[model samples]
Target: MEFDYVIIGAGSAGCVLANRLSADPSLNVGLIEFGGSDQSIFIKMPTALSIPMNMDRFNWGFESVEEPGLNGRRMDCPRGKVLGGSSSINGMVYVRGHACDFEEWREAGASGWGYADVLPYFKKAESWMSGEDTYRGGSGPVKVNNGNNMKLNPLYEAFIKAGNEAGYPITGDYNGFQQEGFGPMHMTVDGGVRASTAKAYLDPVKHRTNLTIMTDMMAEKVILENGVARGIELTSKDGKSETIKVRKEVILAAGSIGSPTLLQRSGVGDAASLSAAGVEPVLDLPGVGQNLQDHLEVYFQYKCKEPLTLNSRLGLVSKGMIGTQWMLFKSGLGATNHFESCGFIRSRKGLKWPDVQYHFLPAAMRYDGRAAFEGHGYQVHVGPNKPSSRGSVSITSPKAAQKPRIQFNYLTTDQDVEDWRNVIRLTREILNQPALDRYRGDEIQPGLSITSDEQIDQWVRENVESAYHPSCTCKMGDRDDTLAVVDSNCSVRGLQNLRVVDSSIFPTIPNGNLNAPTIMVAEKAADHILGKGLLSPIDAPYWIDEDWENRQRPREPKNAMM
Candidate 1:
């Protein structure tokens, strides 16, 4: 098969590219997905998110090669191998990192990607339920709505109030003008169903005559000739191999781990390493998979004095009822991801933006859909958003099917350690606030006993888990940088007609969940690929603590005008 534009890995970015590029009718777009359709009810229903994330049928189930920083633990890295990619199995919380995150991107050589340069694309992709304003889109492909747009659960409101009581600024919407402070978090959900890229961008455009989607087809390697990526060698699920030609460009949307490994297997990486791995080196680029990053988190738990948490609803009968209600009406407890409340805060004073993020869930549980406590309890999922530690993704062989080695040297820096300590300390302060006084019980994790820098450090090493936001392997950077993989336009530094889109091209991991920003990247990239001029940047205002130089947090809570 031959197409003008071929996009590998129909994840968040690939789906968007397929829709946009194929719109011209003159452009034939082929989107290749390693996994099959995302039609399972487990994926369709937002509450069943955990099932798909852990299932091998939907997730890549890639595990890291023992992290040295985590006491030699090999963390589970769940990348979606299905139609929507990770978005199908993700927590569905929509967050675009702090505005300043893009500034750092520009600083790292991803020019024209500053907050002002990229914010328009973010608005272009979002069809927010709350309607359009200066910062959000109202009628875009991806449907986004405030988590629990209605105040169905008091816990959601309580968490936001608690953040205020703990002296954090309370914004109406974090994804709006202000990214800092406590606010209502969003989910890519519409009509009680997931708004994954497949559903949002691909579903509506699937019938386009110029677009072809191939599922259960593995991309073996990019077929390069004269230093130009011409096409790709693909393997069918039944082991049949075929070559598909690309006339214009071959886009790699295989995500952070997959993209870098694909580049390596295709002989586009470190000359010495590729030669050692039995692959002829096409380029001497040493930065193919070097700058890996992810957010590491721990659930700060507290036993609830009252049975207000989701733990009480984990029983089979309760679950059955929730499922029945959702199946019949698409409403009820099952419709929500239950991460309605959240916050972003600076770990220390004088920081230009938030370095920590909080996802307040009503149940004290692990991300694996397992309860940590047998009774009613709640937990605040807190993590350092801006990590300094770096790791890598590299190929040990030339085989396309072989999973690449991934190591996200998490918590290796002193800054990381300090960030963890501050998030934990602040979480304790928030949980102790009068807003939670009636419901809060004993601290269940890191306990009240796990105080001090040494104790907190040890506890974090033993308990912290990956937030599953792996990114920055084929990071975009300045052309002169030897370690830079892609340039600002996402074009590989030493190659032609090849580009890497997705979080893999991120120069730095953003402050919160990656789904929102990844989609934004694809939306922006689609325009780039189409030769369309960028949407005009909106110089919107955002919140920054005016007293940050003198205080880490407000000394008193300000009453929000209702």
Candidate 2:
């Protein structure tokens, strides 16, 4: 089949491109997804997020190569294989990262990617429940709702209150003027269902006759001809191999891991690595899979003194009741991911922005809800948002089915170690506040006995897990950058009629979850793809404590104690 644009992977970015590119009925767009339809009940039910993330049918259960930094442990890296990609299976939290993060991107040779240049796209993609403002978007495709209403769980209140007691200012919205503080988390959930890119962008336009979505079709390689991308060779679910030609351009939205692997398979990566993997090199792009980055977090579990935690509600009867409520009325415990309250904070006094993030849950368990403690308990998933360590994603073989070799090389730097130590120290202080005196219990994961820096370092090495925010495998930057794969326009640096619009194009990892930022990237790229002029940069002011240079806490509030 021939189309104006052939997008690989009907994930977050591809879905957005499909909807936007097909807006002109005269243009044809084809979207390919390796996984099946996202029609399962488990995907729609917000609380059942674990079901899709842990099941191989919905997730590409890719494990990393043993990391030397984490005591030689192999970490599990799950990416969504379904229609919406990782957006369909990720924790529903919606975060745009610190504004300065985008500024850093601009400073790192990613022109037109500063905070001012990107905010307009971020605003354009969100329909925030709280209404429009200079900082928040109100009339957009994705539905963003604050899920941390105190009425949902008392622990949320305690978590925020504890932050205040710990001398941190309370910002009602972290994705607003100020990102560094405790606040209600925004979720991509509307009416108790996941608002994946497919639901927000694709579903609304799926009926457009100009757009075609092919699920269960795995892209084997890009059809490159004389330094230009022309089509894609893919394997159908029924074992049929075919080539779909693109009349205009081919966009690779296969995510951080999938995108780079596809490029290498298509002979567009580092020549040395390609030769070793038995693939003839078409273009020697050394950065195709370099600069791999991700967030690693460890759960800080604590037994709860009260029966208010979700553990009490996990019984079979309770599950049935919650499921019934959600199935019938789209309300109840099943309506939320229970990651209601969260925060972002700097690890130390001199940092420019929040380097650490917190996701407070009312239950003490792993992300997949396994290994529950015997009684009521709670936990906080905390980690450094930006790690200095860098890694790579490389093709191990020429075959399309073979997974790429992912090595995050996590915790290899001294700054990473220091940041992790700070997370634990600060988290312990917050949990010990008088605000949580009523609910705080004995520490569970890294108990109080683990106090020394050496002990904390060991605990982190043994327990840290990927925050599932892998990105930057094919970073965007100035053409002069030796390792840049794509330019600021999202086009491949050395190839024509080819571009990458996904998390993989990030110049660096943002300070929060990747879904919101990935969507913003696609929104921005759509304008570029259609030859539309860039949005006027919005110079919105973000929060910065005047005393930030001198103290950890803001100085204006004289009575505030640090």
lDDT values of the candidates? 0.88, 0.90
Report the C-alpha lDDT of model 1 over 45-133, residue by residue, as the tens digit. Answer: 99888899989999999999988888899999999999989999999999988888998999988889999898889988999887898
List RMSD in Å for every model shown.
Answer: 2.4, 1.8
Instruction: Give lDDT: candidate 1, residue 507.
Output: 92
Off by over 4 Å in 2: 555-562
Model 2, span 1-562: residue lDDT tens:
8999999988889899998899988899999999988998888899998889999999999999999999999999999999888889988899999999999999999999999999999999999998899988999999999653557788998898888878788998889899999988889998788899889998999899999999999899999999999999999878899999999999999999999999999999899999999999999999999999999998999999998888888778988998999999888788888888888888788888888899999998777777458998999999999899999999899888888899999999999998888888888887788888889888898998888899999999998989999999999999789889999999998899999999999989999999999999999999999998889999999997766667765523222322
Clashing pairs in 2: none
TM-score of candidate 2 versus the correct structure, residues matched by position:
0.98
Minimal lDDT window, size 10, model 1: 553-562
